[model samples]
Target chain A: MSALDSVPTAVSRPELRAGEMLAEGGEGRVYELVGRPGTLYKAYRRPAQLAPLEALIAWEARLAEAQPELAARVRAATAWPQAVVTQPGAAGGTAAGLLLPRAPRRFAVRHRDGTSRLATLSYLTADPGQRAAAYGLALPAPVSADRIGIVYALARVLEAFQRAAPPVGHGDLSTRNILWSLERGPEVFLLDCDSCERYSPDGEALDSGHRRRAMTPNWDDPATPAGANPTLASDRYSLGLIFLRVVGAAHFPLQRRQRDSELLSIDFAIPPAARRTRSLLDGAVVWSVCARSLSTRDPARRPAAAEWVSALEEVLDGLGAMSAARAVWAAQGGGTPAPSPTRSAEQAADVRVRPVAMSGAGRRWERVRPPGPGLPALPQSTRPAPPAAAPTRTAAPAPLPAPPSIVELARTGLGRGGELWLGAHRATLASLSRAGRRRRATRQVIGCLVLDFALLAVIFYMCAMVAGVLLGI
Target chain B: MVNVEERYAVFPFYLCLDASASMAGTPMESVNRQLPLLRAAVGEDPAVAEVIRFGVVTFDDVAHTTLPLSDLSLVEAVPTVVAAGRTSYAAAFDHLRQTIEDDYHASRGKGDRWYRPAVIFVSDGRPTDDRERWQSAHSRLTDTGWKRHPNILSFGFGDADPAVLAHVSECKPHRAFIAAEGAEPATVVPELLAGLIQSIVSSSASVYSGEAQLVPPEVPSMTPIPVDELD
Candidate 1:
């Protein structure tokens, strides 16, 4: 059965206008709507699969009236559905998807393979040291201020979302779904609101096909009911796991101790060897939140999203603003830092990185180990020790206020057709891209988008043609 | 503030196959079809895909890495194999040593955790290379360095030499297998592929939580070859 098909609230959308296709997901395809820049049309693969489109749109429409204060904040914080896009049945179309104001560019970063995905807090958390050093991957500078900034921003967004009139709930929350940008301090982008859970006519949870979204056997919250749909408490549990991934260890401390391998999760318990790094974040705010949320076997006992916001705010209060908190750590770094070289640094330098032959050289048996056992310990350097101190707190001299959002755009314009808006803050899009550079980047992105969509269209057409020939349609 | 550094870890799996003239025609055709099926089977399961990376290397006159580790997800079709030249064991071994060294560190640089790599070598004919170069490369590939070393499994079919294949399966005597000479290409190739997929999936399941030892799952129908007769 189609997902978005035949909802009781299934009203045809007039907003489904002509548009240039932009990108495609398994369930839906996205388009840049005609006459509308910075807005997209998501056409569902199985139009019926997007049944919740009406619910999300209706929920959002009610927000301005229900909670005026949070309406604007919620709108800015997420890629919530603004309107639904419909295709006429005469043209062989159904209830497709939504018309969403595109998330700003800065929310995404390019992967090694040149494709860009929404940048998430997980990117910063991965191989924080070596990956950062070797591949130029970035995370918040190993500073508490930067890390705390990420938590505070996310908590604020979650609080705003939960405080909505009906309390919007994202049924699936993975690191990939939450985008983080460290550029203008700490900013968050919560994506794919389409998959969020809403209530049916009977007020029963309307969660289906979500088992396929993001289920990790080792990492999924055990608190989730056997076959029941996602609940708000479960979202909190998942958030706690993300925090664990951010700060210290996993929900369970197990290793690949099978016949022979020891492939430890990055979130594996911090062994005594990693105690130094653990001490720095273990007793901190994230640790407390993670402990409380994860420790509870029951979801109801877990702290609410607003509580997380308050706790994080209190933590920030202890050190003051981001700059003041950073100053406290900087002062501590000045005192009793270890002499230049450590065993780990020397070991990292000693490690030999043989160059792969770009030509017809020694590239015989490229290794991709088969399924079997007996894994060895990962390199010591991959788990480098955290630095000891950054002074606790320092008073910060007040910084200048940001220029008007209009100036922010002229400084780096991001609209289509070279159009510029005053005071328009584009977060996910890189700020370095200026007038001409921004256009080039946008063109490059659009080029990739068009090629992929066109290819998909051709494949679908050919398949339909073949099916018609075979079935004599 | 804690620098909670997390390294992304991937398990490496390599298919080192002999692409000498003997493997031309049906055998090569069988591989072209089977390899893609194997990749699809493993990829359909998320647990295996997240942990195991895949690569392919074929040796005839020389060993060439036709696919890299990350190519597992990128490739839509199995690579085609063309038969020509003499099989060179040295080229395959030496290339493996160099590749393991380069790929291991580079991946680590990108913050991936390194697992003790698994290498499967299948030969349909005996190596025609000089012994000296073969020994040197063999030593490096089986150095037990853990970081650079690979857990090698060897397989033989047709007129292949069982002794040489045994040496390639460095860890133990049980890791080597030989397909029956009279076996049909279509059936044998698919069976071998099925076995390999099972090995990958089961081993990956163990990577995070299973109690089973990390032994290479034995290919079901293939016969165990004798390693004692090796020079």
Candidate 2:
């Protein structure tokens, strides 16, 4: 009742006469507010009024009066709680949902022939981002650079959100929450701010516990206690997974025979799926930060959101995509050897069939499904989920990881905490150290092998030059 | 100037299947079995997996989307589509029209970079509905004056006419596949589906590599079901 008194309570309760239903999610249905342009009302399905949400709602109301600029920024970055919709239903215009502002123009696309479509981030992954609406290319093929740009946009938004006044943590951060637009610079609309974690400056608690929302099991960190809430560190882990998705989306790392459960993980030891991703990301500073460093299951070990911002900004500057990728090398001490040349499609295809391929048990295509006793019985969740609507590709969710920073890997050496986390694969760090040593030796051997090839190539060129000279005479 | 380089969205892929009575037994069974395999294969082939959304439209007496355009990762088991009624190409097209307008090209319709959809249509018999209705639906699907229309790759088996299949394939005779007469659909259907997967992969790969054209693989057991042959 005190919380109700604090919020703008309705005298007679607002009626929904106009405006159609825009979209529905885990929280409630959002309806375009009639008469009042650029605003939408969300009416929750659940009438239960909880205390945690009351504090969050009160904080938002206070922000509107106090730091409006910060509130505006929060709204721009995410659908921040603007006003609690009180529709006439049961006990006193119950706090149904919060009203959200309309998405920006950059959050949508227009067809060449003149039509517009709101674009979600899925355009970058599961759904092909290519279309004739590209306005320039008449023949239809997706542009490859755009996906990178979209991911880049995501990084910037997350950075902005994390740096906000009280600092918003997307409790449910995934591709589904971010709508994108290629019409301008990777413009996006961040949905469901109600579910986002917003702590009071005075340190009050807030949680959405969005279990009912569509979240892939792969996204959840196994280390976090079963009932514990997702933290900012978990958010970083999620971002890192996205970084991998962007890096390797062109060629997913799912081995031909690997199960979905195997795909869900937190260990960042360079899985086969990451090998090519590592190669493609070579030279980029963030690659070291993201692939080598931030991916660790250890939240303390992961870089803060601000660090990501600075690193990504540098990546986008006159370095990586600019000066022919010259300034894009690893962040100095991340001594992971520079990747070899970027391979062509043929080379990638060749690697797929190689007998001694992958650090794992080889390619997915090679795995023959074991029959009878050979295959162990799996738990029910591992079994495919039951029938539902067609799986919307744009809503693809989750990624797995747990890795060490190049700094820590060199310094503390996977720590006591990391050792316990590694469990059965406790020897992984030792093995990795051995592999690192082996890699050094192999690099030297490969260097000599390359030199030998170079010498032979020089001789052949010389012979050819002589032949050309003789022919001319 | 707006940065065109950053403008992009995922490629939308739709499968328009004919579940009319003619394909009831072996052909239908093969479809149910092989479709999941096709999806799994695509998942393994990253070239296509990253660039395309998978959707299905099955038509008999009516056309309904067994699956809306969905993320492949979200896809689990293929719904066992039971065969019934008559082939209504028009109904299928109309349903797609509604889906595109309401779902695909809704409120936020079309500024992102999207590859024109590539549709794979399979038929084992001729349209049971009125010719005008099918033609109207066909016209709407092929029309590009308003928005980008999808590219269709069609298959004709049994009594499904070569002319209609060619038409559905946008008169591209090369894209029309016809199974040999009297052949067991259980065997022939798998080959056709394999070819369809190849085309989908190639089309998606083109979005990145920019090398190949959107073309189907040459099916060993099937011949070209050209429109001229029927005419």
Give the per-prediction TM-score of chain B.
Answer: 0.89, 0.87
The number of the candidate with the highest DockQ is 1
Taken in order, the candidates have interface RMSDs of 19.5, 17.3
Question: Tens digit of lDDT per residue, candidate 2, span A109-191?
Answer: 45343545455443344223232212211221121334444555555556555555566567556555776655444444667
What's candidate 2's DockQ score? 0.03
lDDT of 1 by residue, B94-154 (tens): 5676666667767777556767788888878887765554655666568665346788888
lDDT of 1 by residue, A1-473 (tens): 33223342433556446477766656677777778777766667766544456767666667666665556556765777776656566243345667677777877766433556567544554334423332245554332455555665565566656766556567556655677665555666677787666644333465455434443334444555435566666567666556555433112222122112232222323333223432223444434444455543445666656656555544445445535333322321111111221112111111111111122221122223332211111111011011121122112211232345876666554444233222222321443355557766666566556755876898899999999999999
Which residues of candidate 2, in runs, are more than 4 Å off?
A1-16, A48-54, A57-72, A92-94, A111-115, A126-153, A163-166, A182-184, A199-205, A208-229, A246-284, A292-296, A319-473, B1-231
DockQ of the candidate models in sequence: 0.05, 0.03
Q: Provide the lowest-lDDT 10-residue window in model 1 chain A.
A: A377-386
Candidate 1 has a TM-score of 0.51
Q: What is the lDDT of residue B98 in candidate 2?
A: 55
Give the per-residue Cα lDDT of candidate 2 at A255: 18
Interface root-mean-square deviation of model 1 in angstroms is 19.5
TM-scores, each model vs. reference: 0.51, 0.42
